[model samples]
Target chain A: MRAVALGDQTTYDAGTLTVSSAEAAALVADPALAEVRVSWASPGDSTRIVKVLDAVEPRTKGPGGGGIFPGFVGPAMPQGRGTTHVLRGTAVVTAGFLPRAQEAVVDMSGPAAPLSPLGTTHNLVVEFAPAPGAAWEAVYEALRNGSLALAARLAEAALGATPDAVEELPGLPDAGDRSLPRVAAITNLQTQGTFKEIFVYGRSFGSIALPTLIDPGDLDDGAVVSGQLGHPSLKNPTWVFQNHPVVAALRARHGVDLLCAGVVLSPEPVDATNKELVSAHAARLCKAAGFDAVIVTKEGGGNADADMALKMDALEELGIPTVALYAEMAGADGTGPSIVVPPTKATAMVSTGNYDERLSLPAMERALGGDRVDVAAATALDAFELPAAVVYASLSPLGWGHLTCQEAS
Target chain B: MTTRVVHYINQFFAGLGGEDTATVPPASKAGAAGPGRKLAQLLGDDFEIVATVWCGDDHAAGPEVMDDLLALVRAAGPDVVVTGPAFTSGRYGLACARVAAAAAAEGIAAVACMHPDNPGIDEAGTAPVVASGEVARQMGPSLETLAAAVRKVAAGEPLGADDGRVGKIPRRNVTVDRTSAERAVALVLARLGGDREATEVPLPRFDQVTPAQPVTDVTTALVALVTEGALVPDANPDSLESARATRWLRYSLDGRDVLPAGEFRSVHGGFSTVWANEDPHRIVPLDAARQLEAEGAIGKLHGEYLVTAGNGTSVGNARRFGVEWAADLRRQGVQAALLTAT
Candidate 1:
């Protein structure tokens, strides 16, 4: 994987990208969308992007037209292979309201800036509006596909440019390393309803069989796409899946410290029966693979915690050590219990942070995506103090950033 | 301007007497008492210990006496409240913690100091606590910690994380350099190596409730339908919030045989609610309940149904709603309820 840092440029020159709004709209033309507006929000800009649907880092694979998101944009081929050029420090942000969507914001610079990675990235904000009589599902479908196509087009700018850095992600080593501990990862994907699901290779995880296994490399190549628009702080965005920190962490010490076994994707359903069923399936798969330990993390809110607890309990009961990661909605003061459901046997857990921590955001010089932000009262305000949960991917359940919940005396 | 402070202490701390005076009632004196004088010196001129309140450990332990003592403290109207340096004294520590907690609850800045393992630490609640030593020998240092904490709270500054100056309150979020992924890997490695590393989030204990007795005569019971599915009239006359709702609303089901499509809609953000919109009975099950009523298999259904959106609501709010809902249902002679959750 190679990354080319994007700087201020009207054209692709010296690691800089110049986006043409006209060309970008043409690239993702769809009948579901009546209009598509392209704008930019660079770092240090006094800007806030509201109603965020999803964010994707621009990247393309190889010197050819092959893209990173294989099934969505390029041919249906395995990812995490060959030379993939990433337009680092830049993101293609999809902004639009989905039916029954909650509020999500990203401040370019302020007290809320550190909450989301998009706050620091050079964002190409793509705002999509539905056409007359367009069904919500059709509009959402177009938004997801159009955004991916736009991301691929933007990443093309990095194809002929010089890369700032190159990273090598090696495949799994031979199973002959008996001394090393074999560790794997389980990512719980939110698949409750429309606009609240994750697609693996263009197919929703809910549609797949229980405890589906995917190559860790495919995740890096953008096989996992996020469609969840529930809670911003808890939901996993597309970018996090592409640059999975947990997968990277395991891969970092793959040959030396431990064996990077593989990654399993589990669907977090709403009801209790399905939650337990999926958890059991995931645990059985891990046990069958002879995993020494597994790291479990979830996507979305408290509902996922129930899924995490069941998964952890199933794995621990099967004699596999599990480390679970979660974010807390422990009220505004951080005094409430972090998890809605606690695992009986799983003791090792990592907290991403408290999503309900209050933050005071100052009025920005400019606002992008929308004029009004949907919050408690769904009003337009220049400055306000609200929960950190409103920020996009601030307290990411996947632990993409460094924010954490710690005890204060 | 100097910040005024109300100081709280036990009988021994006030030098009023020892064990025998432990049963004495609450008393107050103007300005600094025994330890308050030292605390005053440590606090410097920026703070004034305007009043000192003392109570017998035995008397303070009583609920009514504690309330009276809190009233006296409230009358002082100090900028901040500082309690104890209770050290290893269990009863004294408990009194100090309760006093601080009460003062803080009333919006007064409050801090308490005690040994970490003091039995009273559990009663500290959300009050900020400073760490102290196990014995009187650590009085000077403990007072110093308390004085520092008073200043910070008085100035509306939060206690710093990981600083020994304060005792544990609850978990707070902070931005660190390493992501939770790195931390998870480290924890995994530690577990694999047979090391017992503490989890960042302590396991929470949930309260258990015994099931209510089933209705003895279904034909004579008044069955109420309740849901957390946020099903409401199309206009939502009560304007119930779509999510994180703090209040529940009741709608009349007086003359309707069915909750027809387009007449009612679900505002719940947790689920798709498409089918529920097509037919609200999937959520409230009102149609089936009505069929049973018409067939004389059960008593007549209640005239109204209660609903609230459960998504993103805090446990505290949910508990309050449950308590209120139970009272309301019982007052209306609701024999049993069918509560559905989203």
Candidate 2:
């Protein structure tokens, strides 16, 4: 990769595309590509590049026009010739493309002037893309195929991702089954120093009536859809995975014992009232669904007191224990209020993503494998060997050509 | 002789108004004020409705409210003070618990009741009596429990085990078995209770802590000011974990002479929305490595600054990260670290 960039041309070697500085300079010399920037993606991957450009025309309003005008008329009738000077910069180029394996191509090549301070912001972006026949092929192929069945089977056999494996056991009958003790689940709800108890039921498990105060329609709408499982919502509109399901399922299925919930809060205040309302509604719904507690999953959005207060009020009112699930929001000793409290009745289960139902079965199975997982587990899983191989399989149509039956096996 | 009792009710129950009226302090009114009438009927002739006091829950929870409540209790001159059987209501339970505890402290027998789900059960449990079961409509059985409680108080009987009806502490009796000679000696000792000098009890002493000396040189000294302030990134990088357990990234100063204050911004993992201008001199290290280098604190900034969102990072993780980061910095010939704990 380094050699190609230094060689004054694009070259694909070991699944990496390298562009020479001379090529980049030449591309920038072109008028049409003047504002473009240079970026790269390894073979068989899509990479988005964004460059802010200076000196651009600004749109103006016509006299007596209350709204946007339809088309461009000859330079406005010069009454006073109002000249607008652009500061900052404009984002001119936003493009992405997937390259073929072992194929070296310049994903993005252009020129952009320097801005104040950083001395002409020139950055070479290189994104890693999977190569054909890599180990991650299985996982990538499964997703590309949208083969829920194949995914389910592979997940069940290879990773133990099964419905029975994910369902929490305490919600099941007391059959003195030894597996009962191992069943655990964690939600990503942020509960403040409160206790949370959750009861998971199977599809066959009779429906329990939610409190009348909570509407049933909301729950139905919030329920995890196919392909988007394991995602729970504090706010119905913007759904994410929960933390407790992972912990709960682990305890319920793999004999690894622990129960926890995840909480997600915007680090900043969100203006979406619907999100807030749904969050408030979901807290009540989850409680009515027999959750012992709720925790807020901390997503690094901005935080608003109104949003936090609303969620807190709902959980406190429901008599549910609330704690913040600590992942990567802020350190416990960091500046402000923590999502989770120590010695809190709330426990923490480290996982990837908010506790969404869509990821529940797979995540639970992952937890069951008894791997030492951390906050970076999701990123590591995304870089899993099988996923790389699957990506290679899907991109075979681009140039690498499909693997033969014998090769696939 | 019937035991005289005074009942306390909030302004809403007193029919004064809603939450707005709750701000008013306690005022004693003659016979059967609002809910007091219903309570009177439930108590029957065994209890006399002496006076009823009306106050807001906030007033009851406030210190000033206690003064007025104490005055009302004195004026009512009742043998017992009985407050609500507040069902799942939070403020109501808090008010009842406060008044009941105050009455007990004044040597007046007090009793309060609430439903099992009431939040006050935990807070009010330390008081003289707290009866909990169902709602007010189940007052017949509740009244019997209250009556039994009053009888025990009047007869000077030790309060027994509580079934969550009255009082926070459960009743328990301690029985001491002794031989005849020991019993005689015990009886004589009891008779001479005040005169006997018991064994001296030792009190535990805490070790004194010395104050830490102030840093002499700002340039050389590595000052770490740990704050529970919110230092989240503009884009909350970790959206999956607790707000407390965020990852800390090592910031580099990028060969700059002076650190730019504006570069240091906080994400929202705090109680307040606004960033704290804690100290004018305190600089947030957006590019920490460079700043340290400029200050001559370290030889060279090394490695990618370990980055973790701190929103919901746990104390355990924070400590671990701090130790790990410190260790890594040490390996890179870095000396003197300034850890800004948000």
Candidate 3:
């Protein structure tokens, strides 16, 4: 994977692509959308973006391959084996007001500026307004389509530019050094049906029959796309899947201290019966893969916690050691138990801090996406105290960020 | 500018006789008394023992005496309050803990010293505490420990492991050098190599509740509606938080036949509330429950519904809310409840 800068230019200049707001609007024009507005937010700028839908990295597959975000932007074809051009330090952010959407705020400059990937990146935000009386399903489809289209277009500018740096991702082999621990990564994606489903190769994960195995390389090439309306702090989004930290860590240590087995995608079913079935199936696959240990992460909370608990029980019961990564719901004052479902066997875990810890966001000079803050109460986006739950990927269980919980007296 | 320190002790420590003075009321001295002299010496000229408040162990345990002792300590306007080196005396330990806890509640920095297993330690509130030996012979070392803790507390420094304090403290949010992902990997490797302490979050003990007996006859049972779905009026008149809610609210349903779609909506932030907004009954089920009431399936329906946002709610807060809700239900003579959790 090679990355280049998105330099400002009407066309591809140096490594950057400069497109006016008009040009950006033209690229993602859809009948379902009433209006499309383009804006820019760079690090250290006094900008706050509310109602954030999802953030996507700009990447494109080189000749003779499917485009970025396979299944959504292009054909759901096999990827992970060819040259891919990525736009580093850049993101295509989709923002809008959805009736049931969870709040996701990105502060360009504040105490929370460095807590989220969206805050650090040079984001090109696409704000969409639904056509009057438009069906929510159609509006959501338009949002996804428009965001992916913009991301693909930005990555296309990186083509023919001098490569800045390239990362050679490690491949999963059948077996490795027996002396080293063999480990795999299993994550549950939000599968609460339409509008809250995570798409794998352009398909809803909820529709998948069983736990599925996919290459780490495919995950980087956009095999997973987030359409979840769950808590913003926990949802993977598209960019998180594209730059999965757990997978990166495992792959980075492959052959050194451990062997990276493979990545498994599990569904976070809402019901107890399906949750049990899915967790059992996921553990079965891990056992069949002959993994010595596994690193687990989950999407959202509540039901996801149950799914994680079931998986841990199943895996531990089979004599497989596992480490689960998750965020605690320790309330605002931080005087509460963090975990919801107490693990019966899998005791090893990593906490991504307290998602319910409130953070006071400084008043921004500029607010984008909407005028009012997206919360249960009515308030302006200029300034407010909100829980980390509303911050984009701040408490992601995948552990991409630095927020953590510590015991104190 | 020295830090003003207020020291508190029991009747015996004040040299006022042992069991005979057990009922003596709280009294105050202008300067260092008992262990305060040692604390003052150890804390040096940087900290001054502005006042010393002493009380009978038995009297201090009473609420009225606690208020009087707290008044004396507050009047001193000390920078920080230090209590005990109570050793193993149960009554003295309790008195010290209560005084420190009271002072701390008024936004004053406070620290208490006692044996680690002292029963009174439970009342120490959020103030930092130093641990002493089990008997009075360890007074010298105990005062030394309390003196150091006093310095730190006065200087606004956090008490750490080396401070000789009891553990099981509160959990705070902090940013670490490594991401959770990196930590998870490192922990997994450690555990695989036979390290049992690799778990970052130890599994907490959960509470198990005995089931309530089913009502013998629903025709005479008083049914009530309870939900964690965060259902509230459209205006959110009470302003219930969307997530991590600390309070639960009750709304009257005396005359309403159904929870209209636009009139009532879910304020929960965990799951998508779209369906609930389109039809509020999906979460609260007030409509169906009302229908059941009309069909004589139950003797009577409770006139009010209780609600709170369950999203990201801490277990402790959840338990607190449940206890209060249950108490209210019991007081209102509600026999059976249908709770809807999202």
Candidate 4:
């Protein structure tokens, strides 16, 4: 896979990634919208930015009309294969007051910098001002789509230039060494109900859903996108969807330690019977696929921990050694029980980190300005004290991050 | 300034007559006495043994023991409480654990050492207990462990995981910094290599509480409805958040037959509240409870309902809510409660 790894102070026309305040105002200049604002942001900015809805990396499918994140932004197409051009690092971040309950903030510098990529990467910030009459659903759609369109436009600059790197992920072997352990990963998506959601191949999941297989290739090509915005410290961002860490981690040791049998795109069911039904089917899939072991990961929030615990129990009962991964929502102090319904069976559990730990961040020198800044009202304190739950700036817990431990002292 | 310490021990360790003197009552001494001298010597210049409290095992286990001991320790005003390195003596071990618990309740740093097989080990709860051997011969090493535990607890140093130079009872609910993916890989590799790594989340130990006796006659019993389903007044007067609720709303239902559709709604973020919002009774069920009251299936309905969003609600907050509300219901003479979950 070829991707253009862009750097800090990354450029569009030999200058910094640029967009006019006037052009930004007009781009979101819907009659329904009160106002819109945009600006270019570089790493180590003086101030912080808040109310981030989503961030999209600029790229035009390695040199074709078919864009990244097909179905939502462009026409549907199979990803992972072929040359996809890249303007890798920098992204267009959407800032807005979402129609639903909450959103996230990204600190560009200070002690909070290490928590999110938003701290390191240069950003083109687009802040939205919702009008009195503007519908929330319309606002959500406009900000998301607007970010993608900006990404494609930026990719036009890197079209004729050569890519910085090429990554190779070989397809599964028709026949592998008999001793290799077949491993399947179950991405436990939190699409069971309500506001938070995840999209698999452009379709939103809810209710009694079954597991679907996702190719490693498709995963690298934006097969999964997170629609859920709450619980930001641990949520998977669109960038992680394009370059999945689990897929990358597994593919690294694919041939030697274990064979990447396949990925199971599993959605959590809200009720008990549905959870049982779906998990039981997943156990069957493990057996039919001849998987020697499986890794289970969950998208953050709710009682999805129960869904993961039930799924692990099912697989373990089948004599399959399973690994369960999640960000522990153990509340703000880390003294509470780590999970809602913990598994009784002897299963290997991995915590991504506590979503509730607090941090005190120093004020930044510059702020990536936004319109109608009610995001300020979101916090009551003047000091930058926040829970670990708010810093998805790095898209951790669900992706590449520290391995948190729950030490009983 | 020196850290003041109070050491507690039993009659035998106090150099009082053994077994025959077991019925003697408790006594408070001015400074390091008997084994307290050894612990005080080991604790170094930073810690000064201000008082030593000794008692017969039977006397310390009696009803007034904890109060008497607390009063003695309060006057001594010690920075830390070091109870017996109670070896194999079950009665002494139990006494020491109890004294340590009392000290902890008074917000004093405390440590208790006992043999693993002693009955006190399990009952010590979150009190740091240094594992001691079953014989008095182990007192030297046991005191060293006890001193270290006291110092660590006093200094507030993290003691679980590989920081094992000082080990305490495992509290599996504390979270540290590590991502789940890395943990998964390590665990997977360990499994494949036929090895075991400690789980990030140890299998949770659940407490089993006895259920309350059921109300034999609903026609005469007063019933109240409580829910973590996040039912709130239309305006959300308390402004309880959609998730991670720390506060609950108590809505008055004294004269109401039904919760009007727009007057009540599910403010929860976890599930679709459309159906619950369409008919508020689907969650809190005021209409149904009223119907039961009218039909004489229940005596009287509590005039108010309590609600909070349970999704990702912290165990601490939930516990506080349960305790505070249970008292409120009991004060109102409610005989039974119906808890609804979303």
Candidate 5:
């Protein structure tokens, strides 16, 4: 029996380098090379090494044509230029030696090159095949047979085990039926800075009727995706994230529990004075909206200055939980964490966007499983990385993990 | 002495229009007509019909129409005003209440005679002499009651304690506490003749019932089969329809198993089968039912879902629909039924 070694198989070939049973046995004895990728290499064929999986050569034309090839082409393969090839034969690696006297039987033949090559000397065109350990079928079988611990790890990672699992509160109690406090006033926040435009994100905005989940790490990507998705109901794609009606409804019906009333301060190199004015106006708007907690997601693509610090101080003085999202560092070192002030109460904040609502339900489900979701934390986990979870948390009864048990009760 | 009286009727009673006229408006004239003369004769020299006003019921009930009617009553300078002893006719009763309210606002004494079953009695309160009996023949007694009420006003006497003859009018001067439970107790006590100074209202304690334990996990949760399957001894028991309470039925399914979709067939006599046929999909349980079934959630269809043609359905009929549908759904182990109201 012959032993074969596996690593990245894109560089290997099957036509050259014929292996005897003794060499295969010797290779198989090493623990590190347990997962073998068999390839054919033609002896002394240095110029052309056919990689079994390289059915199609990379196209050099058009945008995004050159890069690492995408894996997995099921039934619906996209139309493109590429060579079609079939597998030649299975090269088995074993732990026993066969003397030169015995002939080897090979099954599975094809016109293509070996899937992956081990060395990079030749422009090896390797056809792709799953390594022994990396095959999905093998993994699935292992899982079914209880040979894999991945399932347990996944179950552990899920939010099902929390002591007081967060659950969605039943549909908001009927306003007419429940004893609700009459809303005296609804204030619309307008940004007064020279920047004039502040991009906001939240639920019920954008083109998609449903919100996309966002984890903190994916905030930038989430924003881009949300903007690109654009709400089907909106006329202007950019303005979709700035839905004031949703804010008004949230304030009127759900009260401060569901929204964060705040403003964004664009970083310097834009307009320093305008940022201060916008910050002041935001504070006033918060008071008007009857919100005492404000979250400020600092605008990207600018340097953080004293203005950012001033805005934060002003918000803090208003006696509200003030959080700054994506705050760049001040000074020469350029190092500082994004600012966050943990809310002491179940404070409701009104947001134009910043937080996505689609992920609220799932996040709430996870929260119910005992995850402490910090709404104020604009960390990667809380904003864009796991946006769906963020959205779920936002829509949960506890108001996007900002709610404590006492408030929920 | 001939005491001047103004009679106000709506467009319908004045023969000017129908339901369309009910929404038209209030118009006035110098002297009494039709029923106004009948009222004058009943008063018999003691009262004279000085003016008559006919308005659409909708107008008379509206703010602008009421304002116009009040101006007319003031201009007529009638010693008193008399509106319909509106029978069980709801529109007529509503019109009568509006006119009476306008007259009272102008400080002109007014009386509305209505049957005990007339909804106007409840609406107009005790200010109008809401006759306890039927409308047609009770005119004689209604007139006598109106004449006496007018005489009391002319004699400078505060209107006497309500005799159940007239319905009660809401008095702005009466200061009652606004808390519902406290108000309920006070109202009950006042009816019992408890003196306001000595009244001690006892508040009722409301104990919150604990909610049932939620299903532990969606995947492993046991779906209890609540269908009237082989679990019961009798196939069809004689159950009293009115005595049933709404219940929640739970069902569980292993991963990815589709449950049977529950069928909803309207069986109540209140609904019109005509509309149901025109748009069968409107009544069909498709969207909501299919979604629930696909999610492995409980599939429940309340027996005998009530359907009614909203068009031209009287308030009485609508109320009856609500009551009957609620009762039917309650009996079928339904916690809540998806009601599609047109």
Candidate 6:
């Protein structure tokens, strides 16, 4: 937990992080939130978010199991090792009324906001309302405890904070370099729930039945989390399941180039008897965690790619060697048929792009939440026609980014 | 700007009058009219034919003469069109794969040649096509694989089977940017030292359908109740979207039998809607289908159900929603559909 890149008027002792309007109406005091609006945004702002209900990255629960989002609330701890600060150049997002009908947009600046990774940090923009007869499971538990009580009151200004930058990633201590290469990973979530869910510590990983495993120190802080209301650019929120860039690039290249061996998670089956009961117990927990090579990923891109091609054909029918990645709607002129069930021994694969390729942004002097652009106020004036999935928090089902490939156009 | 190709031969490679003008009709002329002057002399100085067209394998075998040779090769705008090495004339190789699939549905970047048992090589869809060689001494290696696939479709690229010397036309694999953990650690160091790779998704053909013809005795069937899972009501009053949905909702079990939870829910985000939003028939079951239609074992049901959230949907939009929900349940007569999915 380090994430410290705060600048442009952000403060964690390093000064300045206000939000006015009676402190955003007393920071989500939850009467199941009758109204809330917050706002902050930084890093090249012409502002232009819309309906995007989730975009986290504000982290702050210092010291192990401090539980900010571990399994979604209160006590379910088990995060990967100790301490956590990460306001890593900020982000909160949330966006107008939403308990489920998903969102992710992030254009903060123009030219497609540097292709959105929440347009390079520093953002807050919440906007909420629910209470006039609440109950959408209490408006999704008051927008998930009012967006984790506003990222723990802006991580209470990083109290005595330290981090300025640090991302080591640990996890090895043992396998004592048996010539590296054990590498594991699985993932394929989207427990198929009311909102393509996943939450694990705070419960509801579709009431789990098997393929679980996950212990890279309970993903180092948030024992797994996400609203990931599928397809808003291939959803995996909860700050990309607590910063999972392939599990922090396998804990920053674990025992060196391989020996990582940590995740499995699974779920995403939905028939063929729960895809042979979770790809044969995740290919027998990747050969009882001995693993020679695995890496799966995938979450929401039609038929969860037949549950990651049934755990890459049950780990290549046992000869091990797998690797999947996944995504791809590929239609909308990307020439359709990107993939649906696959796994006839999934030969390598990566993809993560073309979830209907389309985008047309330009105008924006600022507009978040209740976004107005009913089209034509622009065309002759500024130009708007946006929303064609090029990062409404999308298509990166964790294979991070960069996709081009229409055979490299 | 040089590239305007458009060739498409026939009528004895446009010298006309073969088999009594093979039934005449379709036409077009200006520029490279015969064998398109050897594909504009092997596309030297980069492609210029401009127009050739010629019809008549018995007048392009009907469909009103293939819409008059696709309106004279789409009025020859041509950035690439090409059409015929049609060698083993199975009706001029299915009329040069239907004028290179009607100049690729009008976006125009066709290719087509012929012979791989030419029934127009399975009606040339991804458009590439080349193979040629059952007659006329393989017309100079099928016009040099149609001048290197019309120079990779005039530089816009995307002709498939990845350059195995251009015999392509299978396409739809596309998704290759490396990092399936760097191809699973280079396929586990080439399969733990044995070797053999290539699997980037090539194993799905599932698409089955055949079911119908069952309800013979379900108490005089009419059945109905479908789902892609987005149940409805409960404020979803057509708000729908529970995941790449593409609108389907239908609701109304009219005089109802169950599904009540503050009046229905589960707008499907794939699953776990609190046991179908607290027993909304655990997924539109309509109370075990009205308790098997009050034990008559079933006979009525069809009171508007349908739905549609198959999560990230799209297996070609779930086969165009099973061909528009089997043509709107065969125009609402239904007969049987139970269908339910999480």
Give the distance in Å from residue A50's predicted Cα in candidate 5 to where it truly belongs.
Answer: 80
**DockQ, each predicted model:** 0.40, 0.02, 0.42, 0.27, 0.00, 0.09
Model 5 CAPRI quality: incorrect
Tell me the docking grade of candidate 2: incorrect
Q: Give the per-residue lDDT of model 3 (tens digit) for B316-335.
A: 66765665576567657798
What is the per-residue lDDT of model 3 for residues A200-235, given as tens digits with 9 covering 90 to 100?
A: 988888634688888888888898998887688887
Lowest summed lDDT window (length 10), candidate 2 chain B: B198-207
Q: Please give the lDDT score at residue A175 for candidate 5.
A: 30
Native contact fraction (fnat) of model 1: 0.70
Superior by DockQ: candidate 3 or candidate 4: 3
For each candidate, the alpha-carbon lDDT, in order, equals 0.81, 0.35, 0.81, 0.69, 0.32, 0.66
List model 1 lDDT by residue over A1-409, tens digit each.
2223323433567755777778877666689889988888877788888888888988777567575797799777777767777877888888867775788888988878877889878888888778999998888888789889888877776566667788888786565656799999999998876788898888777733598777898887799999888987887899889888899889888878888888998888878888888899999999988789999999877778888999999999998999999887666656555678889988888988887778888888877777887564544348887787788888777777788888764
Best to worst by DockQ, what's the order?
Answer: 3, 1, 4, 6, 2, 5
lDDT of 1 by residue, B35-139 (tens): 999999988999899999999876675445778888778778799999998886766777888898888888888888898755565456578878888898998
Query: Candidate 1: lDDT over CA atoms?
Result: 0.81
Superior by TM-score: candidate 1 or candidate 5: 1
TM-score of chain A of 1: 0.94
CA deviation > 4 Å runs, candidate 1: A1-10, A65-67, A378-381, B1-103, B108-168, B254-258, B290-300
Q: Rank the candidates by TM-score, best first.
A: 3, 1, 4, 6, 2, 5
Give the C-alpha miss distance for residue A292 in model 6, angstroms: 3.7
The true-versus-predicted C-alpha distance at residue A292 of model 3, in Å, is 1.3
DockQ, structure candidate 3: 0.42
Q: Which ranges of candidate 5 are over 4 A from the true structure?
A: A1-409, B12-24, B122-126, B135-140, B156-164, B169-342
